[model samples]
Target: MKRARTIAWIKGLVAIVVTAVVFLVPFAFVLLQAAKTPDDASNLTFSWPTHWQFFQNLRDVLATNDGLIWRAFANSAILTVGSVTIMVILAAMVGYVLQRKASRLNPVINFFVLAGLIVPPAVVPTIWLLQGVGLFKTMFGMILVEATFGLSFCILLFRAFVGTIPRELDEAAVLDGAGPIRLFFRVILPLLRPVIVTVIVVQAVAVFNDFAGPLYFLPGDENATVQLTLYQFQGQNLSFYNLLFMDILLITIPPLVAYIFFNRQIVAGLTSGAVKG
Candidate 1:
């Protein structure tokens, strides 16, 4: 018994150590590089900077291209918020219906939803479709794209979570003369806060940091997202490593902070939803 316990403890410690080293090494390197003076940063070596210029690097990153970084940040915010809001609400409602309603088409619909998980998106066709709808190269178009791409995962999570909820609650709400909308908003939604938070955090991070969707679906300088702004610090021949790292550090803070603070909530939400019918 003692030997087994000791082995498990050792395994856990090794896993923690490996995880920490994997995540923290690159982060520490970026932090150190971002703090270096331009000359020192240009070297791109691991040695400590003789003169730290964290503020200068931040200012440079922000001020470049007439404050384009801020605009990219704003675009990312709009995309993240719009996509996540719609994703959460629609996914939750649809998940509830799918879990509760029994119909001939339910299995077919469920199969397609599950199929969405494996099927890769056709970028060219999506772009052509958006163009036909006159939404191409637009922020709204990108928002819809991000939402659609994330919808399947969100629906699955919500469906699993909703199954764990008692059907008695729905019946109670209906007995009280509540409609579907009221039942969902007033009764079921409040109970779904945990999984909802998980969806929001995960989807927000994914959409905010996404590079390819914006790159392919919404091209051009005006529609550039935070991830797109990384190119600004790099040129054909030369690159500003300091400003580049600073930009990365700036754009990375929100999701990093979200995960750091709500990590426990994320875990709880994910695990709590596993008690399916």
Candidate 2:
């Protein structure tokens, strides 16, 4: 039996090693490609370059139209931060209320939230709705849309994590003359730090790397985000693989750097959803 368990452990180790390689190799190839020049990029995406052209590529990608990469980066930062801030706060509040104070209507509300998970938003209708409110193709409009899309997951995560918080704390706070605001912000919310960090890390990433919504809803040169900047890089007539690779690398770096930094929370936040029951 001990020998059989040893063989199973070895198999698990080999499986993990293979899984790591499967994800890491392609990423390494992209990194190597991004570090190379036009000559090296054209010859072999996986090969070592004669000279490091990463600085040139980085500079060129960020220096378009004399200096548009920084503008796009700034735009990305705005959208990411704005969208995430709204998503985290609203989702957390709604989740807390829904989970803590269940009502006969909660099942209905939960169904609607669940619909957000399954149903794709009607883009044209959404645009029309926003335009009716005089917000179409605007920064705030896009931020709202990002928040709306992100809310479902954030709410779900908060609901799961909130379940782990003892209701007795909320009771104690209320008995001590604490109102709803005080109870949430001072008492219950701090306990939610771990899950909030998780949600922020996850949703921030989604907001940062978003493409389609920015592509269709917020289309304009003035509002071109990191993903949308690629549209300019790729032209109708001719495409430059070398420049495109550089654009990809520039856009990829923020998210990649973020993942490396918050990778632990990313895993914890995702896995913690299973902790409540």
Best-fitting candidate, scored by lDDT:
1
Q: Please, what is the TM-score per model?
A: 0.94, 0.90
lDDT of 1 by residue, 10-99 (tens): 999999999889988788889989998877888988888899899988888889999998889998999999999989988998888999
lDDT to native, each model: 0.91, 0.82
Clashing pairs in 2: none
lDDT of 1 at 275: 68
Worst 10 residues of 2 by lDDT: 232-241
In model 1, what lDDT does residue 244 have?
91
Best by TM-score: 1
lDDT of 2 by residue, 71-158 (tens): 7788878988898889888888998998899699999989999999999979889988988999888889999999999899899988
Global local distance difference test of model 1: 0.91
